[model samples]
Target chain A: MTPQSPYALALRQTGDVRDRADFLDQWRELLAEAVDRLLQSGVTGGTPCASPHGPKTDVDAQKTAVLILAALHGGSTLSQLAQDPRPLNAALDLALVSFVAAEDNTAARTGTSSSISKLDL
Target chain B: MTTVDSRSGRRLTARGEKTRAKIVAAAADLIYVQGVGATTLDDVLMASGVSKSQLYHHFAGKDELVRAVIDHVGERIIERERDALGHVSTIPGLRRWRDALVQNNALRHGAYGCALGSLASEVSDQDDAARRAVSQLFIEWQGLLAGVLRRLQDGGALPPEASIDQLATGLMGAVQGGYMLAQTARDVTPMATSIDMALAHIESLSTD
Candidate 1:
């Protein structure tokens, strides 16, 4: 919420360059780690490494996370334009519902929708 | 005596109004190309070819000029989107609107990106006035999308459990994020992919 929030400042750029770069790098790392953690836990389905010959579960998860993040920031764009958070809230639902629905499908294959309620998300 | 506008009580003349519009459009373009922090009044004057006196007559200061630009850009963006937003109640219509946005971005070749969003992320953090304006523009944008979704729901194209507001927000977010990624990477693929995912969610909601 600071005046220097990355994307808001990325284009306008009233802040230090090194600071902005550092913040962005940190953000990427955080998102990557978060996705990896989720995949490793199987909460998002599939192992973090999955298999050497199989789809790179971590990479796939990170991609999805980034897409979800983009939708979110886009939602914020809409929210800012509208001056209301309702659309942003709707976007959160949009990403999560689709996500949870997919996860439920995977979990259903494993005979356990039980973990769906476990995640605070 | 200073003249007063009947609507907003601002002193202005017909020529002054035209001059102001010209200046605002020039300023918006310049600001879009160069960030507001970097685009000066002199640059605006040079780009717009409007005399310094006229600029001063219409706007008290740089901040005033920037505010005017914000309003001008807001109006212009909404105007451009009006067609797709209105009278849309079918699933195909939603796809058309989404595709049109993607096509518009593609036409730009992923350069400069969204007119409003380009300014939004930059100014949203810069000043209180700019922040408020950006926020209001997004709200307006979301309302337009939500209105169409609501119509679809009423027509039973969307399930009764569907929330128009959320779908609209999610759909808008996808575009916003897509623009950001596409602009930063100088690629249109992300924008297209993001729109697809967003639309896919909407498609999933459709009874048809």
Candidate 2:
């Protein structure tokens, strides 16, 4: 981690920029701030991702980390209140277990790739 | 919602708790990897090493089992955060937390979105119980983050006018969105970029 991780620093510095049309929306700005805060906060628990069936995978922790960050940074159809990143932590527990169970060493690198295929906007 | 029979003092039997835990652990694994819609009671049974009759006894049905898994996930996740955040109250502490996240995500190259979001997208519409369980988890998590934000505020780490509730909500959304974008894009850039931007904006508030 850099002395001042760029994202965390960004989250700490807040402003309502009125001039820029690209980054002026409240929701967008809020998301940026939250991401920054999350980056600074780091992941709370060292809780490893569970992959019930598969051998222990290094991706387990990474999976949990990304999922939680995604929840905090991503948008949802639910109410804004429901959109809080905190849910990411809860979701990470579930994901960790699943990852442990389904550890596919061969396709580990591709997991992210697969997600990208499905997630493209 | 089923009423808890408080008057009757109905509680999970020791056998029931063991059975319930197995089922939840199995379900948590299967649903997250296979997608909730793709997973089945049979899968849960096979993974959990529980018999059909035992599964039914522990849970009224599959929906109930999913709810149980959600609860289990919520408990585990909440415990993890409480432990991590409890370690420190300084800016450096917060940085450690963020470092953990980035390091973890970078490990897998940013694959897989959140389990809760996965369920929310796949099963929320089909299962009322699942929706409620997932929703409850979100509420609890938000409360936890808000508490942390409150601490930051009290320390004057955050601006006096900062809204903890809003900040918590925003943080949650960005994480979710970043995952979605990352999954779709097949790249970690979206996740990394989103977080960086979010952090920059958050720090802006501290300047005041």
Candidate 3:
């Protein structure tokens, strides 16, 4: 996301949100929509676990989306601190591990330079 | 031993040291609650009960004082994590560490988020020095978590092929991300779910 994006601003916000409940609710909805789109793209790439075509897969994708969203929000903060992209990459890699094809997962686990490592998050 | 103030290039006596520590602690608390942008030197002075000259004597300006606050907060967090996760070697130990973190945030209803993380988010773009300080603390924090994962690997719990450092980094992301979401939602469910998902992933890799 761009630095000026609402998500980016929210990620960096440290103030109290007790008075902005409606704003937060809308932000969460927007984030969830974005996550759903990302998961749809991942599914189209033949990642079965994240496919939105089936009921069970839809639930799994929702769960995975939450993890991915968390990683993005959390990882981006760390990435800013270190001025390095590896933390974000590593975080996204792990969050998406469950949906990765079996062979790719093994490749990642064994440190064999999988596509997950190439993610430019 | 005489402690020297790095910014002022002055050696501090015991009383001077105590005064400096009090200022830093107060500033840290203010920054934690109101954020760096909203917090001012005057507020810090009021909260710390130190004169303007005394505050300046210890720090060059607000930026310098902020750096000091970063160090002070980082040290406190690292010390607490060391105590909590020092001997954690099994999945249950890791879960207990997670539980304590979640429970602590629940007390504030996830209002304040992680102390070091909230500071990192606020000052990272504006203050490069403070960013580096916070980055160092995160590295140390990640290292502590990696140590626990390494122990699990060595004990034949986690597979030998697993990368402890990456797993540790992922876990830290989950935590910080969880805290952010939890703070925004004013509920601990998001934080708990985020962390539990990361832990579950690790657990799925367990051989024992």
Q: Which model scores highest in DockQ?
A: 3
Residue-level lDDT of model 1, residues A16-112, one tens digit each, is 5456435544664676577656655655543335556443332344445555656556656655545555545555555545444545553322212
> What TM-score results for chain B when candidate 2 is compared with the true chain B?
0.82
Label model 3 with its docking quality class: acceptable
Query: How good is the docking of model 3, as DockQ?
Result: 0.48
TM-score order, best first, reads 3, 1, 2
Q: How does residue B18 of candidate 3 score in lDDT?
A: 93
lDDT of each: 0.66, 0.52, 0.78
Candidate number that wins on DockQ, 1 or 3 = 3
Candidate 2 — number of clashing residue pairs?
68
Per-model C-alpha RMSD? 6.2, 17.7, 4.0
**C-alpha-based local distance difference test score of model 3:** 0.78
Better of 2 and 3 by lDDT: 3
lDDT of candidate 2 at residue A56, scale 0 to 100: 31
Clash pairs detected, candidate 3: none
A best-first ranking of the candidates according to their lDDT comes to 3, 1, 2
Query: For candidate 3, what's the TM-score of chain A, rounded to 2 decimals?
Result: 0.51
lDDT by residue (tens digit), candidate 2, B1-208: 2323222336766666666677789899898776776789988888989899888766777777777677777778777777766544555565576566556666666555556656656554577666777777766765766677678778877767665665665555555556555544445555665554344334445634
Q: Which candidate is the best by lDDT?
A: 3
lDDT score for residue A6 of model 1: 49
> Over 4 Å off in model 1, which ranges?
A1-42, A45-66, A76-89, A102-121, B1-11
Model 2, B200: alpha-carbon shift in Å? 2.0
